[model samples]
Target: PAEVPAGPYDALLEAAASALDANDFDGAVQAYKNVLSDDPGNPEAKLGLAQAELLGRVQGMDPQAVRKEAADNPGEVNAQLAAADLDLVGGHVEDAFGRLVEAVRRTAGDDRDAARLRLLELFEVIGPEDPRVTAARTSLARVLF
Candidate 1:
């Protein structure tokens, strides 16, 4: 992918990052969307939007409850998904990736697709260049194939 040049959107992206730092996920999401509207293929904007959306989704969640649910219901795909989100937010990147990859290994049809998509979204949030993401990609492909 070609790099998005340093342009007016730089300030907007900075503001979006500030919003994320401040836990203002809605503001960050909107800011990212605004940038995407103008530069549809901007990688930074895409990453910011994914992070904002994930933060928003997990913001109200109780970590303990989510973890318990996931642990108790290993076959429950949604529970796994929620727990994976919380794991990523809590900086357990490996745990998040492993959980979803396991989910993909054990599930089929829409459930497998959901877990796979969530894992991909997390890849965007973490940046595709991260070694962990690369490892997870390999793991995911192993399960998928």
Candidate 2:
């Protein structure tokens, strides 16, 4: 990656991104939270927080904390993705679908791809003709086909 302007907490953010890339998600989350506490409106910080929270949820932990973050900071793609995934994990398929849809509305990024893949898998689980399956199919087709 080309060099970019240093963020407010360059050292901590670098540490967090490195930890996240290394899959030391717990440490990454703490580091991200540290930056967020001081710079709540930072997009990079918001993205880190969202991704870290998602990673925690994927590891069978909580994700509710990020829901409000996603709602408040709509630019955080990772949080929206994580929120959608967490909703699915919690058996709230409809809620998860809504989150993914909201994600699509918010960011024109790879998060939509992730959401589409998850929606496809979830559709399989929910079975065809279920409202969730239908919605997911429609949304997936909108982007993928």
Candidate 3:
């Protein structure tokens, strides 16, 4: 029996996971991107990259402030998106999905489209196999078309 050595991408994947664990979102993103450059279909690298990118956008944001802004300005798409991001990071998966679904229900035209796009991005972050994502997809479809 012959033993196979680990591929070079293995180190990059490890670095990406380590960076994610350290909350070094930028580092994780770069590492994941490096992995994808070599193996574009790698699910773990894609998921890691998506999560890092989402976390990077919301990094250093105050959850309470974002939530208050969303509450105070229900019509503001950016505020709602920010609040949803915070909720996702905080483990409030249902809250995150609900916020975006509500936004989709209330908005129209480009605003509605924007909310829909953000919801899809959240789906990517949460992964398609997650039950929460499955439920959210059904809710989104009901609100959408």
Candidate 4:
């Protein structure tokens, strides 16, 4: 177990870590829950929980979960981007749309450009013939470059 928290915390963290590595989402979710129950202020616990709920990848891994790690402290854009990837891979077209929509709404620069590029990639994944792709493209055109 975790000697730091000195109890269920270590075990909880361990369980969540193992589950996350194996992509056993439900197990990670439950383990993270236990970590939070013992130490809501623990950064690892918070990050682990968010990671468990996060649906997609970012920066070669999971951004939704990473975003949870910093909690607006930093790298939130990466997290958003990760979420967009997740949505695309998971076949959650609307979700991918939403993630990019929010990203495009940012300060209107690199982040927006990155999001637009990612949205375009998703369109390719789903195929340009998809209606959602049309709508996503139209939305991107309206809100982004």
Best by TM-score, which number? 1
Which candidate's lDDT is highest? 1
Badly placed stretches (over 4 Å) of model 4 are: 1-75
Candidate 3, residue 119: CA error in Å? 1.4
In angstroms, the error of model 4 at 45 is 41
- Write the number of the candidate with greater lDDT, choosing between 2 and 3: 3
lDDT of 2 by residue, 1-145 (tens): 9889786699999999999888788899899889888987666766676566555657754566767877887767777766777776578988877666666655565766666555554454455668767876676557554
* Candidate ranking (lDDT, best to worst): 1, 3, 2, 4
Better of 2 and 3 by TM-score: 3
Task: Score candidate 2 by TM-score against the native.
Answer: 0.48
**Candidate 4 lDDT tens digits, 54-132:** 5323325654665464346333566676666666656677887877776777636786777777676566556667888
Error of 2 at 66 (Å): 2.6
Per-model lDDT: 0.96, 0.70, 0.92, 0.68
lDDT of 1 by residue, 30-97 (tens): 99999999999999999989999999989989999999999999999999999999999889999999
Tens digits of lDDT, candidate 3, 34-143 = 99998998988988898998889898898888889999999999999999989998999999999999999999999999899989988988899999999999999998
TM per model? 0.88, 0.48, 0.86, 0.50
Ordered from best to worst TM-score, the candidate numbers read 1, 3, 4, 2
Clashes of each: 0, 0, 0, 3
User: Cα deviation of 61 in candidate 4 (Å)?
Assistant: 3.1
Deviation (Å) of 45 in candidate 1: 1.0
